[model samples]
Target: MKRLSLITIIILLPVIICAYTYTVKQDGTGDFTTIYDAFTCYDVQQNGGIIYVFPGVYENVPLFQVTPNSVNIQIIGTNKTTCIIDADYAFYGFEIYNVNSNLTIKNFTVQDASIAGFRINSGSYGNTIIENNNITNCGFQANASVQKSALICHGNALIKGNTFIDNYNNWDYWAHEEFSLGGAIYIDYHDASVTDGLIEITNNDFIGNFARDCGAIFATSNQVISISGNYFEGNGLLESTINNNVPQYCVIARFEDCNIVDFNSNICYNNESYEVQMGPSHEQQGLVFKDCTVAQIRNNTINQNLDLSATEGIKGIMINATNDEGAYNIINNIVFYNWDGINCMNDDYGSLNIDYNDIHNNPPAGGNNNYVNVTQGEHDILYYPDLDPLTFQPIWNSSTKSRCIDAGVPNLFDDDNTPSDIGAVCAIKHRIDVVDLPSPSVDNGLKWLSFPSLDDVYSTSSYDPDKAGDLLFDILFPFEDPELEYVKHENNYFVRQWQGNWQGTSNIFSKTNGYIFQMNEAATLEISGFKVSDNTHIKLDGNSYENWIGYWLEETQTLSDAFGDEWNTGNIYSIQHQDWSAYYSEGTWKYKTS
Candidate 1:
């Protein structure tokens, strides 16, 4: 640690002491009432801390301007679904322009942003993170061609772990000099800085985003652009306009003039456009890269259910590399079920390396030029990727191991230390059909029961991490889940088994004891979160009706042995059979064996 001078310490003491955390709860319990007010507060603007938005709708709010040169600001929401920013078509959700301070926005459901959702224009906020948000339907529904997108970034920002859906622009404008672009996100960082990866877009899901150009994400950057581990499905339009020469086409992603591009491990499925055959070219597939110095497009799975009417061209990967020194390594990808596979354009300038790819089942697949290079080792394949029908993941064949399994480049190992799979690291996902409750029990008409969870519930990263093993009422039984007496919960005793009565008036939820709940007729409630694994000492009341015991230990033990230390003579009845239980009476322990 570097020692600071006395003068430096004196100068920094005031700023260090003034940091504040502002809470925005609509119920008048927090520091501020609205999100705008909490963010615009003097203390938050000057000396930044977290502006924690509790579970409630912050409706009709405008941009809370970010003051330059402030400390790191973090605006967080309690839950993505409950903590809503309903723009009501008034303004964009949030914006931070030309500030060096690291800003983080997480866990909010932003809806109906008339102009846009989240726009982070210029700045080297290298630590600027926007994650776990649901930004949906945020752009102009109908407008002339203009630069409107769900998220627009000019700086090197981290856009990760978010869901962007239906941020469309139904522009019918005639061809103009500038085209409306990037329905979901636009990384408009053009030669702003050569600093690599100020704009890292990874692990995001872009679904059903429509734009005249670059339906999902567009980046024209001199910096290193990395787009990995993302799911782009149902983006762009299936129907194309009957334009003779529009100079605008739809694509999941388009990167132009970037210094370096790293696009890997992305799933682009069923993103198609059946444009009429025209002299003007259109990209109707996963990605389009133009004029990038260096590009590594690897490990991507692009599968399109070829529309029979698709005429012009529907390619899996499209590239226009004109730079003579540019190096493009297009490898280890599974491109199938489309009209065409990989279309490398103007490659006389750039050195294009195509190898180790499973490109098959095109109207000519594999390589467009049989459609694939059927040669061995480093060359591409012209075979079928045996995939499960229900879930589009690749399947492992007992006889003749699947071509997709060990088809990737050698030495690049997977997480399990085996040779990597070809397509986007897919595993067969198990699906359980949705089961509906019987409105009320046909036998007794009782409703509420207990948590689907058995162990102690823990806090999530979106929620406060401080409440690690503590499950508060607001955390588990959120108010938005409808606490309408006896339905979501029976009554608010909170805990029944703990020896000491928890502060009923306070917000603390007893961790050691099991609880009871009463469902209304029968309603759907979803509760799935982290669980604490460490041993916790539980104080039991030992009263018959007071306990709802749980199997908390890792090893199985006899109920008599586990609770023999405490005075116990109670019946343990489960919902399966009200009378079937372990009971103790007349100095003998009885077990109702399953």
Candidate 2:
């Protein structure tokens, strides 16, 4: 066989690349003017590549379909806010059926569809990524009687960092039957086993989505599902005229057969119904097995969930399981300020282990009637966690730190060196130093001034001992007579004495550089010879005096050298600069001139 020359090989390489790229712009400037046109023109089965959609509104288009045998095809929008796909009267926004793996749809605003925003059929089984998109106002059909969702994924996928809002199904609005499963997302595996890799839903935000059943998410017949770091707010709203007796849930995962579900590090707040309703709600939750084996619910913050009915019972976490073979581990969570904290009903068949959780302020916190059978763990606290008002994070206040610090399980470690905190956020300590003047004391014929006390100083310092000792000085004396005389005492100290007629020369005490000068009127005097830390809160004569100091009264050090960590630097000093305008440098005091 003859080998091809270098020039011939280079010529054929371009044709054999097996990938093609196209662009879609609403303004007819890109390779294609519409997204439907790009999909129809590209031979995705033979060469799979990306279709980049610029920022613009593409309206009234058919379903953006990914044909079968299309592998590694990505439809990406430039921006989620600006790149809009408006399917006002279309059946669906995107339909991926029996497609090859690795299909990614990201960074787009998909809205106004009749059926759903994205529908991934069962045959597609790659780690498809649906991320950074805004899915809203879809799944509204009055005539059709079918369950609807913003996104329906039958294949293995990772849905992360997406926003689902205002998506609803109005079948109940016209017809008597309620056919709404999930307003935001629905994950269905039909009959697939748990061996399929888990479908991960992480870091997504679901808000204001409404449905009859599960408003935010509904997962059914899946092997393993991991839902973490997601925020669910104001979901699970039931129509007023419709059947209000049906239970509405923000997150519902029901597995008919044996499976493991891990739900952790999520925030579910301000929803209109149950925050989490897991396991089969049927069977009256007796001793019979419903196939779910392991459920780990930990590190979540749930709060303020209310139902439409004024007298209804709302729960932050409601687990109804009938399987005696299953094990439920609920630990290290914050379920506070809600209507009910953990309602575990029909959990007698399963082993319930609830421990290390901060559950407080709920109407009736954690009861067997509510489905929480806390057999082994410690009871939840009733005090407030002292969370930050703005961020809702646990602040470093004494009430929060004393109870939550190092309060997790025996083996698990917190972010700090202590044990884990009993909530989603760990407590971190912050140090602040305060300095202020001490009270004056008199002994014999002399009066002495003491140094200021350091407040909230916890640990020992590595600064020089001599410099620390020199921070205290005695220099004040009382003068009661009309004529005052200057006298020199032992240890080079100076004193003020009463004279009958005349006073010593002005230059007598002037020669002593360390003597305190007594003045009739309030004058600015410079006094120096002490070391202090910068950034310290200083007070003089029982008043705040931080503005009069020229330079840092305390020695400055780098963050690494001061804290032994690279996060905080500079010493904080609070010095009271009253009538004296003075500062210290190199262990010496100097008065500032007016």
Candidate 3:
């Protein structure tokens, strides 16, 4: 008997699992009308499934708990801002009970809940992803104490790209001394140090949340906790005015006893009380063993916390981790306009490395501005960052450049292939084309393509391969056929056929030219490059019969804005998406359906 090759064996070893997807529409056109009834179906609840909710205001939503044996579920909204699941201050958000199945909730406005927005109870082993949501006014208690707020998570969870606003812990008038867990998110106290207990909270926004203790996040985890790329503003600024004695201990995040804390690229602005504190928890009653954190806190920008009238705005970052094993490196950050800059004074573990930071404007009578409790570091500087007040990016329009332009450590570099800046602000790319693959033709897998993001100036010379996934889209053995043929229309139809493992001519690829993709299967094409433009100015081929034009405009625009003065004069175009067209005749453009 002949044995199979390793590649063929590996490909055949995988099992193909079929998944069911249900759509919930408010207009009674989809598979289900209500979000609750969609999950309650026997086929969706017993087996794994996906539910897509359409754009509408869904009212009076109850607490949706993950039942036993219900696994691998996803509830996604059509639009992030429009599709709303309004709880009406009556019920809690979605909950995951003691199940080892994965659950994902994305792109919804989960608003006005009485308890946690997305609660993951203990005994959950699978991953829970809560992404791209607007969780507002959830997680509230009437007269109770020790209440956990929005996005209360346990086990492996990823909370990313969510905006949380005004999710209070308790609404009691006289509970000023009440012990609050977390205002926006409480990692429901670590559950016994399992190896698979990991949680990552990244690229989220926390604004105007309230707790008696921590006003934003109070995370207690034994897993590797990574909180990065988050924006925190006005946390602890909104509080109950009836009894306002309790101070917001940590305004942004209070991480307690994590295994590894990689806190990077966060921006905290004007939040009340201490911003981003990491220390051992006081809940263990001074018998903590696995609490000394190995932290890498770098490239963060903490600015202008509280007005100091509350007297709780103490430190920008108060890192109290007595490192038992690994080191704590605090580098390349800008801590400005605070009561105190940093208080990483505790060196009982003797592994505190603090350098290359800009700590300036500490409110005149600020607290510890030292690196080691007594003396300042030699690498720390007091310089004006010259940042934009709104976006927090470095000011680049003026002749005088910002001091944080190229001030980071020499080994590190920014995402723009330049020397890294000091603060959390990074440059956003000018043009990026993230388009899904167009629908495949019924007859063949051939598709029409146009490079909307390719720069004509950059493509004239050599191109950067790393700018996109690949500049030439990997001409090295990508085609299914040994000799694959592709055509592009420039002055004339130029068709080229190349064999496998041979790089084709790169000059035929241009944004001005349209091509036919000889693809074997459908796949997403990612293209990002550096090109500053208001709108694409296309110089159409005058000699050619027709021109293929493509422009990357995010929003809808008038036809005149795109083609300029030539829009209505004598131009004719066909929209491939809608299969509609408008042909110019006798100085008039008339629409026609195919």
Candidate 4:
């Protein structure tokens, strides 16, 4: 009988709890008509309950606020697309201030906000999760100084899987000449108040955003910014095209101080200046792009898909460490055909290894434009095609592939565990041709040879090394010097390096370093590569001896055999006579008439 009485009391507990619990709906089923109406009515619970928001456009006007200890406010949405909270002309779409731990906001779309999409300004000790939301056109008319991101907050936040497109500068549209650019997301660290902000912005797509300075994303502040596995494209807009007053300039990442900014496995294309532009000269941040000491920027593609400027200002990607010095590992990227592929201006003694990049067509004009330029004071080794160092041969001529292929340090191809290319793509030798060497040796050291293939001079028809992860096109560009003419050889011949003597066979071909060799006793060496006496030298036993018998010959025996004249009277070394001892080393040797 007592067990039945305890069961009866437990069944009545739900009846008592439902009588006091509140519900919010637009249809007027409860006391409140919208979700924000329950903020002041809901009390703190040990295990916080759910607040279901029905499908409708809830205009959050007159701005609701959540107090401290309002833990576990889970606003469950039926669907993100249908459940819209439009914050028109307001500073934030959803503002969370003074909330306790475990505040999850998900499965909702926040659009058309005046400032940030979702802002967390002064929250303390709360785990904020903002995921699976489509935030667009939020910061369309915000201030340039304060407008940083689509979904921005000051506390520790995890912003993942949310799409941020087109957070542009609308207020300063006429100031297009200034630097401002970012499309989807922007994270700034709060420094005035003493607090460290940590955020993880990953797995998001940023497309078609316009900021003259930082087109896709501009992150600055005294906070930790971690960016990985994201795609950025078409964020650079022409500031002049937008409006005369519009400020124009764009960059991917521009930040300063207090943490790590690691960019891994990302793709950035069609932007104006660079994928990631660091340093405080773009801004007045004290820490600048120096906060991230050990930056790991690897496995990315910074290609020039669409070029708007005729000059092609800075078509490829660049990394500039204007003030600080640390380990910057920039590996495995395919950068091609844009003024410069990879430009690193490190201001210290730290080493910069730019290995395994497909850098091509910088000047593209066949005269001067495409190529990597390194400023002085940077202790770095630049590996490019073979240069004569005197004549500067095979200057690429601004094509994707030229005869200057595989001319870099061969050992850096696959020796290290890092990526094998230099700028962005790795160049493979299509055909191997022997390089012209000053002298040949059995121990060629595997260094004096470069195989120039015809297939390496032209790019593959349909292959894009920047896309589809295939490097077939990178190996197909023809790498021949534009200034050279093609020639065909029929037979092999040797050139001798002698100037004068007696001769035998006319079989030796005349070449750059060729000369005549004496064949026998009455040999007459006829050197064809140089002029006779003044511009040439003739030596016996490898010494400049005085004419003892003939004119200018070190020995009269060599001159007497050529001119049949005595060493004393023959004008062999004369300007007009080839056997005159007076014009040779005069009075230096004894000559006798035969």
Candidate 5:
């Protein structure tokens, strides 16, 4: 007992009462009187620590202009309902500029500002965590003469689990008014040039906002974003009067030099326009949806509540790939629709795969008039379990007896072998297919026939894992040719084929990382129980070769480290193109830098 007491005292000794901690109350008591007074009392020059705002209504004052490395300002509330930041006075409320990191503003009700409720002008790219805050009734002008955003961001921002109600869209007469100007959360890359910044907006509710232009959570230039698990109701341009410029969509991506927009596990319904839109303009001139891209638009229950007179359900056109059609621009989806569905240009040479969809009621399909018009240099092909007579609407309501049921090429769709089902499904406890590719050797350069995820079975990892972790992060090279049997963790197996010559079809490889493994080689290599994805950062081993391994990443491939150098997959290394740049010999993994 004595020893325990001494140890407890030692641990407690470092705990100071924290005398500098400034506390503010609404009734004008403690360290400061009013909330704004507390904000002002703490001189950015002297007091530098926690600034706690006790429960009360703080109306109409621009709280604090955070100075550099001044202090880690934390605006804490007794509870979510008690704390509030009212902009009943200032034109723009809570403008944060030129500050260090570690700025956390949580559980505050901030509303009624002339411009933006919360504006992040500029700050060090560190940690800005805004959580559980209710910011609403803020306004933004939609006219060509003025510019505003509800939660305007100029640098890297992270906004999560907050409710933004009735924000943006203050203009009623401007021909083009955007309700969710930044789509609730907006971002523009540094200097509007693709310099690789991170913007994550997740699990938020955005209702009754209007932005006449781009995404509800819009971002421009070079930025990588993840807009996931968000609920957008009555979101988009409100075409109240007829000036002919209603808002377009729930989400939009435009003129993005190099970026990624991932929309996953989200429920979007009843918007004025298409749910999501991506383009380099209507003509689809300069869109490149490749390497830095892969939208897992699966398991999304997209119901249409469009005004009918205004927009359709969902339409995605010009999915970029403008630079290297086959290599840089690839759009794959397993969309399961209830109302209207998706439509896109057909470009086979562009390497787009659309499989296992519950596509109903699409006019001008099958017969002599296909839904898509194939331009001269486009490669548009549809792979499915068809009657092969090119029968359109063959599986309609009464007569359509789930023909695509179990009769799909799953291998081609989920190259990752995530779900064994043909279309996108919600059931998590489902089986998955095996991933199989070709072989390579000293004779041939290198080739991977395909992921072989088609057959009804559980298999192994597609790529071999290095000594450190799983094989290639994004794609796991297959182990066996075809395990035809349903092995639960079969796809978890992998192996790295040693130096060798290989050959096969172009589609036998992945467009993600620029390296090409031996596909369809005469010899056989077997590996099992190997894991990949965010784990093993495997690349063609040595430095005998430069940029040229056995293959190249697709054009849109923006991976900095092809071998998983960075700890995580998304932010670090990336693989681009699909061409062989190196060959193997002398008992090792060689490369061709030239």
Candidate 6:
């Protein structure tokens, strides 16, 4: 045989060493049927490539393990909602241990694992991106001795646009044990070898998650971390039966030995425990820098986080720092409607600056003394900021507009104009446009709306044509019986009567403009061309409304104005669209729904 020339061998190598692309489809129509088959068949060690999974459920596979120094790979899905990797039998959905780098997992739903959805072990040190995935129902069957979470990141990672829901860890697998740590996400440094680790968690939704310590997220000993623009709702709290009494803090970032930690622009509401807890616990906060060198906590909206335990009530922000050299800045945030606002325990050495914040209405019974622990800056407002009921944005009024306008730091600017309002956004003036309403007409009336139950009931709003300031409205309906008695009041308003829970008649007053209605529960009412101003807010029972309509157009106009008396029960109605022309131009209001 004749020996091949150098030019002939070089040309053949280019065709042989090309990267491979594999498609894993559940329907046996692709290159591989299972994800494990794709990993085994592809030349991952030499030439790493993409494994695109089609839209279907892939179940009963191994832990989808990736070894150390493996080829850089991407496991992508056709759709985040449809493509599901259900590792219900395995300990974890994806166990990446000591991987080199450039591992990307995106756009899939990973659920029902015993330990965790994605477990990135300690030695994995690379640029990792975990985005647009739903990690749910994990960590429930984890071992008693292990600490588990839905997503555990021990490497430098960027986690964004993911939904973590209904993930729980067992309170105590053994009798009288303190075991579980995080429910949704846990970020920790395993050893000193992994230095300067950076993790950014942004724009994710954490809902209905549970654990012993932190329900949403727990971060410790990371060098640099930024958590921003995330929505955490209805998370935290141990089951009522568990006996563990440890202080369960939600969204904890205990950076006892770290540098540069920023928690900003996050919306944390309706959670079960403390909204945020940062810094050390035992030492004097002002004397020694316990955890973090520099910390910036700004522009976060924390509301309605109450203690799950009746015996132990919860507070809003708990910052315990002792570093004189480092600075802890809590500025431009809205800490409202909790048991307490900001409790800062700082030693003489630590520099704790609390300024330009709206801390009010916490523990409505307690006076101003329960608001702020530190001596706030001159611009900080203590009274109710009068946030919009629906959007939670600051309304254009005396209480909110007077003190918060132009109050933030010189560098930061509000959304509206030069004068920046406190909290997340600046005050923008506009009218209330009914963006959506429950469709099929029946699902609109007589529904139970509460935290974690009707939590997904959201109606969109915007500032538009009417220019009616910030519009807030209340929902009213009779319980048990559909028949309601109406009496016209003196000021062109009507007082409607209905049977109460205590075998007594309850009376509600209607507004003259035909939009606002008075009831026990404070709901974010949607009315076309309505403006929300001064009104008394009353907290009602969890199951309050029986026959709820969006708004009562004319109080004396009877059942027809209340979106019709006949409604189909047991069917869920979703909002289709709001007929703007019908309400604005014709004066006859009608909400079009499917």
| Number of the top lDDT candidate | 3
For each candidate, the alpha-carbon lDDT, in order, equals 0.64, 0.57, 0.65, 0.46, 0.44, 0.59
Per residue, candidate 6 scores C-alpha lDDT tens digits across 1-594 of 999777544344455664567899877899988877776553753466888989988873332335555466777898999999898657788776655657778899999887789887635456678889999998776345566789887778889899999998656533422446677887776466656678889999889887765667777754578888888777764532354334444433334455777888877776754322333331101011244677788887777665433322346676656545667888888877676677755553357788888787665555343444577666677767666766666665422333444556656765533444566655564332232222223343222211111101112244221222212212224344322222222223233443453211232222212222223332344432223322322222234232222332345664233333222221212222222212222333344433
User: Per-residue lDDT of 197-305 in model 4, one digit per residue for the tens?
Assistant: 6677777777766655555566655555667766666565434344333343335555544345666556665554432233322211101133344565654555453
Best by TM-score: 1
- lDDT (Cα, 0-100) at 467 in candidate 5: 19
Worst 10 residues of 6 by lDDT: 449-458
What would the per-residue lDDT of candidate 2 be over residues 1-594, giving only the tens digit for each residue?
999777544354454664678899867789989877776564754466788999988774433335545467778999889998888758678776666557778899999888788887744355578889999998776455665788887877888899998887555543533457677887777554436666789999889887665667777644577888888777764452444344434333333343677888787766754322334442111111134677778877776554433333346666667656778788888776565576665665457778887777564434322324434357555556666654556664312333554556757765544456666565653221222222222122222122222211221243221121212212222234221123232233233343532232222211112222232222221221122444544332223322322222235653224323312222223222323444445544456543
The better-scoring model by lDDT among 3 and 4 is 3
User: How many clashes show up in model 5?
Assistant: 79
Residue range 508-536, candidate 1, lDDT tens digits: 32334334443334444423222333454
- Give TM-scores for every candidate, taking all chains together and pairing residue i with residue i: 0.63, 0.62, 0.62, 0.52, 0.52, 0.61
Ranking by lDDT: 3, 1, 6, 2, 4, 5
RMSD of each: 19.9, 15.6, 17.2, 24.9, 17.3, 18.6
Residue-level lDDT of model 5, residues 1-594, one tens digit each, is 455444444345565655256777866676876655655553632454566778888775444444444455566666667787788835556766554545666788887776677777553444466777887777554443434556776666678888877765444555445433553555555554436666677777777665654434556534556666666565554432444333544333332333556654454445444332443222111112333333334333333334443323333323433444342222222222212344343333335454434333221132221223422113222333222122211222222222333333444433334433233223222223343433334324344322211111222344222211222222323434321111111122123333331111112222222333433433333222212222233354333333322222447753334433442422322222234333334433344442
Q: For model 4, what is the alpha-carbon lDDT of residue 375?
A: 33
lDDT score of residue 428 within candidate 1: 30
Per-residue lDDT of candidate 3, residues 103-204 (tens digit): 788999988777777777644457778899999888776555545588777678889999999887765555534435578888754666476567889999
Q: After aligning candidate 2 to the native by TM-score, how far in Å is the CA of 285 from where it should be?
A: 14
Runs in model 2 with CA error above 4 Å?
1-20, 40-43, 59-70, 122-124, 173-178, 240-258, 273-291, 307-313, 364-376, 397-402, 414-418, 428-594
Question: On lDDT, who's better, 1 or 5?
Answer: 1
How much does candidate 2 score in TM-score? 0.62
Which scores greater on lDDT, model 3 or model 5?
A: 3
How far residue 176's Cα lies from its native spot in candidate 6, in Å, is: 7.8
Please report the TM-score between candidate 1 and the true structure: 0.63
